[model samples]
Target: MKLVVRVKLLPTPLQAAALEATLHACNGAATWAAQVAFERDARRPLGLRKHAYAEIRERWGLGAQAAQHAIKKACDAYTTLKANLRGGRYGRPGTKRHTRALSKPVVFRPEAAQPYDDRMLSWQHQTRTVSIWTTAGRLKGVVFTGQAEQLAVLAEYRQGESDLVRQGGEWFLIATCELPENTLNAHPVGFVGVDLGIVNIAVTSDGECHSGRRINRQRENDRALRSKLQKKGTKSAKRRAKKRASKEARRNKDINHKISKRIVAEAERTGRGIALEELTGIRERARLSKPQRTTLHSWPFAQLGSFIAYKAKKAGVPVVHVNPAYTSQECSQCHHTARSNRPSQARFACKVCGFVEHADHNSSHNISRRGWMAWVCGARSTAPALMLVA
Candidate 1:
């Protein structure tokens, strides 16, 4: 239930310059840390390394306090690397996470909102411009509201539990409030299935398909234009490239927003709990080429899920995630196993039971069923799942 609300910073030219300097410092610290770590690891593959703070102060000429901060960041990266290794995720070598690279200098929590202060503020138009104390500050366009309302609610419901995060950059937060405990149905509402596909961005188990506006044609045209510009390699070409990047980014975000909002609306109207596959791992599957992988990630399924959960909670609805095992292949009616179930992208035909349905609908149905099974087996609570089914 942790959420991060982000807002843009409207800074003066001088302030913007200061922010840029802060980013440079953060990047410098990261580069220095990376170099040190790389050298140490190269010398001894499993060598015990010096403390980040001590090394930063000694080798990078940073103050004790500044050294401590850099060391803490390095330690966080170390923890992430170790966790990834333990989880069998050996990919590209560690580098500065984008958020870490573009972070701003620390400012006093209370003074953080002061316009003159280096730190940025997160404001809401309540009775007036209300500001909250947050640890996060502006790096680029995004600023994470560290003192998030959702975090407060989570702490109240689940004491002492915390979600570690590094956020800030073109992200916004939405939250669900006034959530009720399990009280949806006599038998309890169960699951929601979500199918992510290319033709349609999402297909819900609830008989609703969220269609994506076909932009592939437009993207191809844009790519062709970029290729032409690359051949020219002129100043105008560079300007066109920047313009294209900005335009495409905006268009993609608009698409994501529409898709996510529709899913939330469906969940509220249908009263079904939500189910999402652990998509983080699936993005790395070898079946997809680099471009295909990029397209899959570009769909913003995770962001859509987050939107649904928070919006559902506000309407006294809930969401639950279940394992996405053969949701695409398993026939919803007879549990038949075969690739033939999905002979085409849009259609599903059951080989075992002669049941047929739209490919997305079948996946949604199976997702709902799996969530109910999990609930009955006491794997998780019933309230969240009931919202979707009821």
Candidate 2:
């Protein structure tokens, strides 16, 4: 039940530079550690090399603890993957052999970064402030907090609403503490089906659809701006370039938040479990025109899934993701499967059984039905029957 929330960090120009430098140092350390392990493993596998860890430490000039940590991480990754390969789900090798970069990513669990304070810092936007070590840099009174509105973003973090992290020029945080265990209302038990598409963002089996038109327009505009900026290639162009980049990133996040909230709210209102497509071969199977590929890539489907899952968990409702193999082609009413069932992108007319419905709506219904079957057959492990919403 962990949740994270991310807000923009507005620091003075000098402070920004210092933070950037700190990140680079972290990445550099990780890279050197990874190289040390790679060189050792290449010489001899762990079975033959008794001095593998020692060699990496001496060769890479890394401290004892850092060398040990890197090798341990590498070995754990390899072993986990090797096990997965031996137990093939569909008789295909599952060994993920590709190694990630040294600075793959850093995760802070209870406390993200170092220098943890025994006592938690209270949130006081007007009076509370930030300071850095003097020896690290001869700087004082760096303005870490901007306007009241900017600092307002931290209120959720301070109130124990989410966790936070800063990485790769962005911030990500989740609030895990105050998630409500169940909704406080009385409604009949049911299920809601969700259909994911490339055009319209999502269509619910409950006769509600969320449009992705605005997001699509924004991406198109970004592409056109990129073309223009590439041609201009001046200082002003560069400034404008950064501005658009930041704006678009924020825009995409906001859209995802809104769409997720809407879906959660709809499910809560109906006192129903959520049924979503467990998209397996989505990327390879997506049939979009070349011009639409970029926009489709940025749709944030995984984030949407996470948002729905966490929200449902908080509300004491169940969220189910079903195999999406035939949700698009199967008839919700009669279970008919044929290309003729969907005469057009927007229409669904079953051939075996004369059932007519909207394409997305039919897909959503099928998704919900599949989830119901899973529930009846006790196929899902983590999911149990949802108690009454009240």
Each candidate's number of clashing pairs is 8, 13
Best by TM-score: 2
What would you estimate as the lDDT of candidate 1?
0.53
Q: Rate the local accuracy (lDDT) of all candidates.
A: 0.53, 0.58
Tens-place lDDT digits, model 2, residues 173-264: 22222223465222326568888887778888888888767767767889899779979999999889888887777676666667767887
- The predictions' CA RMSDs to the true structure, in order, are 9.4, 8.1
Alpha-carbon deviation at 195 in model 1, angstroms: 1.2
List TM-scores for all candidates, in order: 0.57, 0.63
Candidate 1 local lDDT, residue 7: 30
What lDDT, from 0 to 1, does candidate 2 have? 0.58
Q: Best candidate per lDDT, number?
A: 2
Runs in model 1 lying further than 4 Å from the true structure: 21-188, 222-250, 280-298, 306-318, 323-325, 351-356, 381-390
Q: After superposition, how far is residue 33 of candidate 2 from its true place, in Å?
A: 6.7
Write down the worst ten-residue block by lDDT for model 1: 110-119
